[model samples]
Target: MLRDEKQYIESLRDGRVVYYRGDKVKDVTTHRALRAAVNHASLVYKWQADDDKRGLTVYKDPENGDVSSFFKIPRSSDDLIERFNLIYQTTRFGRGTFNIIKAIGSDAIFALMLVTRRIDSATGSKYAERVTRFYKNVIKNDPAIAVAQTDVKGDRLLRPSEQPDPDMYVRIVERRKDGIVVRGAKAHTTQGPVSNEIIVLPTRAMTEKDADYAVAFAVQANAPGLKMISKPERAAEAAMNDEWFVTGKENVETESITIFDDVFVPWDRVFLAGEWQFAGSLAVMFPTYHRFTAISYRAGIADMFIGLGKLLAEYNGVDDKSHIRRDVVELIKYKEMLRSTAISSAMMADLDTETGIVIPNKVLTNVGKLIANESYMDVVKHLVDIAGGLAATLPASSDFNNPEEKVYLEKYLIGKKGTNAVERARIISTVKEIISSFGALYTAAMLHAEGSIEASVLELYRSYDYKDSKKLAMYASGISEKL
Candidate 1:
């Protein structure tokens, strides 16, 4: 069953130690930096329950008659496509922004379930069973989860075990009769503050020397000794400028430095314990599934960029300008490119016999993500060109409230004869968000979101089958005979 907004909000009071700006926050539902995002997360829950969205967001489990979200284990290509639509709809709901913390949880669990069985094959371990049990626990509880990837490597020159400071990457510190205690931190944990669980996985492949670092587990977000030093991300907009700015996006997601201070993991919760061989599998599969989802959701953001760029050109009376038309066309081309690439990737997906989950095609998936990560900055560049510099010098929300300033500011700021002063102010304020530091930083994050550009290139290079191309070239050049 889908949890309501109220249930999700009230759950935040369960003693999660969340700190922001060097201060502790008792309840995220009411905190200044967290309230809006918490509410936004709540809408995800509410959307599942909404009658109009039920067909798209909620599904009936086949084995058990329980209500489930499309975020559950996808059994076939149809299920994967449903997830694609969910990504598009959710991004549209937030008006171009995608709070992807939930996507991380679902994608991780889906990939983990498959990879653990592979681990079982390589090593005679019951890791797959443990992961299955954990899967049932999460579905029954349906807790919001934040994935803790990317470790804070103190030195780029050293491996996890070779680090001068052993705690640089999260690793098992002590072994107990029943479980293990882990001590370390994970950086850039998106949506860490508002979540109910934190799923910890390896950041890289590990060797036997790095056995302690080759661990995977799930723990409560408010577990003993757990601390989240959070940095919230909020889209800035003038309070008096635009209703869309004020109402559409109030609270945004957060990323945090999550520290595990010798946190305990019970036997039931531990999925991988010192299984060094499977570390590489975990590293590759988790992000592969994540990148598959990234391309789908990011396309919607690209669409929003294109739509806004076109609107700005029209309002600025430059729609007829050759360059402005070309800019908007380029934006549209990128958005459609991402969308088509993702769909193509999904259409030719493969299924795992053990987990029965459909996986996106590797080459097209990487290409789609590469498109968004590589060109989003260019998307921003084109939007800025169309909107012009007024986005930065626009009057503040306060000026519109002052009677004397309101008359003069609106009169001068109004664009063309067709648009009004308030309309132009609202448009300018919206444009400000796209060109601001916050906007560019988010776009920049996409480059290294799933992995860096080099990583994606490597994956594409390895996954491609160039044997036929090479053969054709040899025959054409007379290097090989037809016989």
Candidate 2:
């Protein structure tokens, strides 16, 4: 029922209780450390309001007489591709905050998958009707929805049912005629406190004994008994605020752990309940959608890093240096490789699910994710190398006004013709923040998020067609007998 940027902001400001350390946070909406991220989310709404971005943010759905997010009911390959492009545009603006965009895309994709699955078959549930209407209302008003996927997971060594603490993963505590009361906690929830609604799901496949943990639903971010505890920011604004103007702004959003103390979810919002078999389907489907979005979104992030590296090369008067030029060229190679892999995944995509919505071949998409994971980090390292020592050694902006230090800074930090030493130093400092600082965290996240390096390698091993390749080798070599 939420609509508009102002309304979305107001929803987060009112009645939502968030914790940091131990005490309840009264106002995270404007807190400096958190404001950048909070504001970045708000801009998503503002984009819908704008004449330029509105085209990308909202779509007309024939199922309902309303506008909705592109992900709410992406029925065709074109619909899916547009969603990828839209996310990429937003992500390019905040390559520093593309992680938040990734989180948003992940939940949106899951929601669409659910809606599509429900609507396509006569035997399917009417959950899609409820979601379609919800999404329509959101688009007409432009509300923000966050997603919670991972569970707190008490013991990594044990399954959800085998864990010593039964409540570690969120599960149904009680089912009522009107609703169900959920008791447990969700972790790594991005934009948890500030969103209008949250789509919650089981982190992994569940066994028969884990049915209670297999439930999936959408609940208001501030639903009764729901409490969000925000994680600390990477570094305070003092380190990057001034530099943001000279460089790019940091997309500062927070992720958090959300505790549900017997929180009730009404029947209307509960999509999958007590359907343990569907839990694994949801788990596999959601990450494939997430990886699709990541393939393009992270490619855009690497593109930005490529730009910054070129800028730093020029600023350091090494634009003409052969080795520096080679470094810049290598960075481009990595960046382009990420783009090609992502685009190929899109081009080769086919409809694999019962739902009509086309999904990127998981094998190809995972390859894209793998290439992005490795190349993006190398891009960061190469950029740092080209940026040189000043990125790490530059003094704070506070030193700019000190009369004693100003003379020395002015004499030695100067670069080339037509640019003052002070200006070059400022530019170099900003570049340092991008390749180092929180920017480095974003680059690392590109590779590790969704799944880790080991996970991707394992998937590659599982997905390859080894038996077919073996058969082909035996036939071609005339060794018809089985090995």
Predictions in order: lDDT = 0.80, 0.70
TM-score of each: 0.95, 0.88
Model 1 scores worst on lDDT over the 10 consecutive residues at: 235-244
- Model 1, global lDDT: 0.80
RMSD (Cα, Å) for all candidates, in order, is 2.1, 3.4
Each candidate: how many clashes?
0, 4
Error of 1 at 136 (Å): 1.7
The per-residue C-alpha lDDT of model 2 at residue 352 equals: 49
